[model samples]
Target: MSANGLVQIEGLTPPGNAHRKTSKVMLLFPPEWVPTAPYLALPSLTAVLRQAGHEVVQKDINIEMYDLFFSDTFLFWISGRLDLQRRLLEERERRAALTDQETDQLALLREKCTVEVFDLAERAAEAKRIVRSQDFYDADKLEWALNIFREVMQYISAAYYPASLVFYPMESNLGYRPGVSREVFACLEDEQVNVYRDVCRQLVLPVVNREQPHVVGVSIGTQMQLLAGLTFCKMIKQAFPHIHVTVGGNVVTRLQEEWPTHPQFFNEIFDTAILYEGEHALLWLLEALAGGRPISSVPNLMYRGTVGVETNKEIYTEKTTALPLPDFDGLPLDQYFVPERILPYLATRGCYWGRCTFCDHGQGYFDQYRGVPAHQVIEQVLALRDKYHCRHFLFSDESYPPALFKKVSQLLVERNAGIKWTTLIRFEETLQDQELWYLAAKSGCCTLYYGMESANERVLNLMDKHAKKSVMRTNLMQASQAGIWNHVMAFYGFPGETRDEAEDTRRFILEHQPYIHSVELFYFVAYRHTPIVRSPEKFGITIHKQPEYDLPLDYYYTLNEPGGLSCLEAMEMAEQFYQQDFHPWAVRVNAREHVFLYISKFGTNRLPQIYAKPEDRLRGTDSVSGLVTWPVALGEGDGNKEDGPTMTRVVSHASGG
Candidate 1:
């Protein structure tokens, strides 16, 4: 039976003799998946397999590609190309001729060549210097490191693909939408423009084919990874032909829900696609595959069947707290693009307040909120600390549960678990407690990112964000005062939101600039099946020309009213906001440099006097090393003149840099 008929059982095809159980599995995180650290899925899955006693190997191809692409050897090769082009251009001019197009091209190259050549050489020099320098992680040197990295990546991209090839937050120009299926397919087969494909061919396929793992898993955690993820999967399937391939992550989970129409497109790339909390689901499927058993027993999976395509019962009720700690064993800890190793750990799963209208917490992507016990979480932390000598951690949760965080902080106090971390947090009433704020800071919560989608009360209500603008303001202030770096996330273009809300948000950021160290502004993209999309009328909006999708893609949105802030307008506002110096503390919404920035400044739970002047702000410095001295104010160090936290400059022989 096809899409029109009753589902039959014939389509199910198990891996043939070519995919015989080798008991070895390889998990890959493709290029542009992430820049700084590896996404959590690969490690989580790898850890599960390792615990289950399966031979597993995992590698972050993004970081490997980063190392190779940014090497001096690569830069020299590019320099050679530029030099050859110069010679060829002169020789051609002397040899009597140039076509109009060739003349235009030569002129453009000549105009840009000197600057490009010099810039590339300078970027190379800076990179070589910073990588070898002792103060590599210092703010200034790190910025130098990032600049050179950006240049090298740009060089690669301009030469082939037009992708940004960023690391801090994975970004790319490759198509990720449902309509781009054919484009993605072409990209996979194209060797000329597909840089990510080239990356997989050089770094991915060889290692994968060498290991010849029976199962290959790819994690498409974000839209940024979608295209490359699909491309990588295509390469694997084409090369091996019989290796079982599966994909899971937020993107896959959401797509499976909205377009349950088992996109045979997905079938072409993946044998099975796992959704939701995948620990048990993935493990069960692997167990079945290895044992040569029928896969119907596995839950939360979609597999193509002979009769038709089908999905198994969802992994709806797994208690995440009961799951084992995520293992980061097989990852390359040293090669990440960051100066300090920032490992990811999740204390909880899903958003506690699942009512945000634009958010899809209810959509199978998010779990019904739950948290692991503080002690169990700490045990894992200690183990990871031992295994990977890194103190920085990023809590990869939708919203870091305030209660769980406080509990974890108290435990960190009782037992000295010295790890500094940052995470996305909700600004709710619970944060009114000053003690909670203090405890969070003392427990090494370096930054708390607040989702202040809008600062206008009406916009907040419209989005069903639950928290008010006042609450957001107060929470930010308290968090900042508590010695935590408050990072704000703002998005405009909520259906009913207009200039009023946009200005209100801008005003709030300006008013509380000291409290906010960064702002991640986004122009809202209405996704399918979310509350906004399900009932556009409720928000007085009319979605126009919405095409029925065989695969999941979020578009088909229009404002009911005339000439309002469309996505483009909102984008313009965000660009203006970023370009202008709207506040005293530099609002960095572009890169993940703030992680190292904060580490280089505040080493512990100490109060550095908040500087009101932008000039006093520190960017990169070598002096921060000495600031890692004794405890700031130990326990109950709130406001006592003697024992309380006191403001002081880093007070070191910090150079101007």
Candidate 2:
């Protein structure tokens, strides 16, 4: 123990339980559903637990699981064959145009065939020893995940029908951003399911037998993580009858407010559930468990008993300023893998302007926003830098309240905190304070990720996103002028958007190409219990109904009524927009050296000329051959018919106008 005579923070030592002798806690990091990036949440939570005088051991099941599924040589061979089959199916679809009735029937048949193929893909992916055999895998529960994936795919595919055709696009939200190939999806799904099952077996069983802690806590983020957490909890209870299990994470926090009261929920897993920010709720639950007190008094806990779930008072306590900064020393720093080891620090919780209709923060769970004191933030940064040698800091605030950002920026400057950072901020707020931007740059702010959900004013209004498109554009331009990289987060296929609106978004991207460094897009997923999900009819969309306990990873609905794009058509349009406009722009901008050379040779004036005749421009004899023709005058009789008067004026006017 330290000088304070508390329990020494070290390795896993089971907690104090009445029935179990050894007391240990195991913290698990779930598999990567979106990207194969390093797990940070587990390490951060481990740091917090260690600081609280609890011995914590973390297991990143994602990496191990990924390796087990993808690294097998035999599986690659099988996956290649699956890809060939999928291509054949696509080719067949392209070669024929069926009547609407025939199209509907064929779509159903195609869905069935795809489901069967996915099942085989999942099995082949899990064929390795680390995930399948009893020695490394749980023999009885191995098929549990395979079954779940098969059912989820079938259910979601059937529910959404042809509309979900765009589920796997060429580019996605993951870091790799490669086309969603059939083989790749098979490989990823296999890895996700296997990792979850294997980790649950290894971690949960060990904790159950050797370290039956008072509570088994699972952290969830994505749908895959939620499934794994629930399955693991079920297994834990089966193995150790007396132990109670709990779950808390972003997914859980979002779901628990209007948490469904299905029988499957109580019969399947988890004795108690914690919703929203779990630090305080978990601490209170642990205290009650250790003191042998009743669980009903525990705030923010949903307890499941013989009768039903008994939820305690929803806690909305004031944010504690004195909460200690997460201690990173206890975690395996070397094992942590990200594109960059971005040390995450949250200056606040919730959003200052939580008005977005689709955002969970504006809902019941995360309504309050709180900021940490600037002095404390600086101190934490100093500790992170000195102790862990961190270089890049990722501020994980909901919106990084502008006032707090200003204070923190000033403190960083005052304290000489040499830390490079990136954060999420509101465009309107950034425009409101230029001094904050100046100070932020002085304090090593490298990038600002701005939320501009849609460029169309009507779409933004429907989504309850308060910021105007005009303000967003102006702020983005100013941010570029301030020498800060701007990453725009956009969404497509909101309920009321039309094909025309999507076209407008595409146009907006082209018009403001200079300011946006990168773009991230997500197709809307109607989350359960949200106002959008509950009252989608009011938004002029039909909500597809699914089974009570069934939560689909890619749940979507169609805006088939008057003012919206049909779900399938909207998705196809969005995909086309990405491929035709957004992606090409990203490719051009990201090729920095090439873009620089082009700009230098042709000047900005020649950009329109190059874009107009891309085929000819690309076929130049050499790089210099392309550069030599920049000053050529285009008279009205010039053979460039595609270069209309409007194009010529756009090119010429920019030179002076």
Candidate 3:
């Protein structure tokens, strides 16, 4: 409404014929891990665009991306190649069993293999090397693995769906491993180039010909994701000249600081580079395209031309609260393959405690916390419940601030808007109020995902987590007492972590098994933008003398502690611990019940029964709360105090009878 002539929403629309718009926009989510659902970015962006009257279609390319590479055809090809290699090995073994002349003949036969077969053989050899070596998993070597994966994907794409809209999924620094330095990570440019070419030939060309979307937008969340996005954009431009392309998201917000001098950074593949939050920028770009206005003149857009890329001086308002809750109704919700279709909601942007050293969000743009109003949040919850039957909502806030949680909890209780939810919370903040935990439970809060990063005090200090082991333990116990399940996430293999320290963490988990519902263990990988990655020497750790683009696996280094596990070993141990203690089935059960219990309580017309027994009511409890307090019987003094001793106990309580 200010500059681009786009209409902004003021009040609610009465149920009637809303005028339909003609502009078509396709939004793409690149591939990522199967279990971890893609962040719900496009729905919010689409809602904004739709409010401004644009027909938007979203595609989650993750399933397709996985399918393209892991299909039966691709598997069969790999299997056949493996068989050929096996046969060659067997022939050599047979030759070893025979005369030297026979062995020489067999070697000659192997040398006479075709180019394609030889390439397959080489790939098999490399795969064997990858399986055996510790260095293969490093952050710097991730690109090498990705390149290998890309080739398989490319081969499959050529054989199958040629001309699909290929969106490269975002990659974060978490996937990086040890041994690989940043410099080695950067050297995999050629592999990325090949990936781009394959994407163009196999996907972009066909989609452009078929659907002819007016504009294609690529989202970049991390630096690695940005590289993939840039690659896709260049391919899109070269293959399909008629369509407009745009780039936005977390990476775009910091692009100016990272690469300010690159010409066509705003141009070439991208007609417009959206800055800040993209909802407004997207609408402006579309209007410019449809109305035939100069692309360079669009607000919140940076463009390129004869002189250079011109950035408008217009400062976009960060305080716009008129935005709609993400329209998931339009998205392919069922297409999302997860144990539960997690409804991700952002109550606020930025962190309440922005003092954490390792936080990129604290240092990045939108550093201040801006929360959506309570009424607005309730409205969105109602819409999700009524329309999509969504009962489980995950707060995607950096930290679900205590004040906001209290308000939301109270509102949910008052309105009787029953919904089970989980959020990341500070240990001390939640522990300070028992009422908060009780209210959270009454309002159907089932789980609290806590980032109890380490058991070691030094490691915690280095990370600036501002938490103590005792505080985390107490909060976890209180949460269990409040009937709220606790999911403890721990980071092992931090820079200064010793074997004894790792064992102590393991021992701690064993000691507090009853209070904690599940534990997820992760190996620490230094992110490029983080303080630890920047100043490794401060913590007596070595930063890899490599480029920022390199993956973690390439720069492997050892800990100073005697008999201490390397980063790779520590990561594997943590993964094993997670598998043993917090299996996938447990997570699924928690996630599933998180929604089902809430919906059962709210959707049907019966008042939810809070207590599990009649005696609970007799105990003068208003309603039976299913608070899961750990019996003090399992603690240090009350139990057989020997370490590493396993015992099973069956206890009967009279209160719940």
Candidate 4:
């Protein structure tokens, strides 16, 4: 509405028959998710919808967007686009002295225009080939291939000037605050920086026109995906008014309370939002849309009622045992950015030990815990393996329980499923048995990611982790001895953790460097749904609320008495740790998937070839301070892992898929 004549998206419901029968459904996984593998949400929801006799076409636009970024056609198109921008910027400059922002934009456009598109495109294609072939095992080739992706991403980012787009970690910023609803609406229609608008026009709308589906569902799993996912929804609603657009995912569930306040979201963006555990909820919502049942009867749904937007009172949780196996029929499984097909199979919903005070992962679930039996899990894993012709699996469970872990390991050994897999688990006192680690390794368990949040017992108790140092050390030693790659996740700050306690964690990782294969360190964030935020006094912190961030899932805060490390100190300590203490964990391969493949191929965690060269390590030591810092790529080490079954939500565990 500001410069372009796009209508202000408010109070304008598309002319769709909301209660029309829905038969065919097109589900979309939007951009900014890790492109290494297909997110489990689409397949999970597709299985449920198809089981109900509905025609479903699941599309992973995230991977498609990445795949498009490195293509000759797209790169050439980008070059032309940059040239056009250059001409327009020059025209503006001729009229008057260019503003600072405009000058910078023009410079970026000019720089991008000079790139040899043909050469770049050829190298880009080769890079993709290297990653998907036997050449992927060569460490140098793989590193070059990954760097090529980052280079392409840089070029693409320049084309969309002012928006900082990135390839890995899915941390692309569109220069808009997604937590601010008004900015979100503006970002949806902005043609200048909103690359997603172009993405939708080129990739999404054409499919909608061809498929002519009755419903289009977009899964938004993380805060990083919010802008892109909502852009798809609003665009789909605008282009095909007859197709009801819906959204569901971990992010949606987290923002459920914030959504109803903005009724325009329901009126213009999406017709409905299905909250936590969407398998059965989505199926029933489709039935309601088809007029087979009352709209009010649909559970875990937020819809536009006569009064305004209304959330259904009922909550529905799927019975893990009765659900159909995830259907990956419509997904482009081979197109993932990996040499081998890695399928994510979730055996559990929600964390079994759901006691982390600073974690809000439990809020994404209607039920605290629900897991399929060990035999059932084995059957499903084997079934998925055979059906997909895949030997690698990611058990995307939230903190795999000790009992289930042991039983599954034993079963995998018994059946000799011959599948290499990994998952997230705790340092359980019950799992200290050496035989368990041996059995797990024999069953093709290549790596295990642990949430070793702290090394000091006091801090652990405060975080409700309750993990003992002795138990953690024993587990790591046993896992390493059994040839399992051990990746530990720790944070710098809890509410009252002092510098000494944070040092205890750093010292622990340093002392146990041989046992720990990788480490991900992060500063703490007080999420909106965590117990600390609900009762700030209990954690001795003051929550600072910003009026502009209407849809915030996390908050800024200050310690009440300032005895412990302040937030700024926490940030500095984390940075210092990464800069000074990064040498031991800073390997040539940083991505968890890449590390896992190495472990599986080499049959040991002692991967000397993956380490940085001696010169590189020495260079790190000679940096601005004590050592050189390695550029870490966050594949599965983001430190904010989500529960597996919450529809494509990713967590910080080392299981990338």
Considering every candidate listed, which one attains the maximal TM-score?
Answer: 4
lDDT of all the models against the reference? 0.61, 0.50, 0.52, 0.80
> TM-score of each candidate?
0.80, 0.64, 0.63, 0.92
Candidate 1 residue lDDT tens string, 194-247: 677767877889998899888888876545567778888888888888899988
Off by over 4 Å in 1: 1-22, 76-134, 161-169, 174-179, 257-268, 314-317, 361-367, 545-552, 561-568, 581-590, 593-597, 604-657
Question: Model 1: which residue pairs collide?
Answer: 10-306, 11-305, 11-306, 11-307, 12-305, 12-306, 35-167, 139-620, 140-620
- TM-score, predicted candidate 4 vs. hidden true structure: 0.92
lDDT string for model 3 (479-569, tens) is 7777776656565676767767876777777788777665555565554445665666665666654555333212334554455457787
User: Candidate 3, after superposition: displacement of residue 504 in Å?
Assistant: 4.5
Write the residue-wise lDDT of candidate 4 on 433-509 in tens digits: 99989999999999888888789999989988788999999999999999998888777788899999999999999
The best-first sequence of candidates by TM-score reads: 4, 1, 2, 3
RMSD to native for every prediction? 9.7, 15.0, 14.6, 7.2
lDDT of 2 by residue, 311-421 (tens): 775453324375566655544444322222345566665567766666543332443555667777888778877777765676656566666777888888888887777
Which of the two candidates, 1 or 4, achieves a greater lDDT against the reference? 4
Better of 3 and 4 by lDDT: 4
Q: How much lDDT does candidate 1 score?
A: 0.61
Superposed on all Cα atoms, model 2 deviates from the true structure by an RMSD in Å of: 15.0
TM-score, cand. 3 vs. native = 0.63
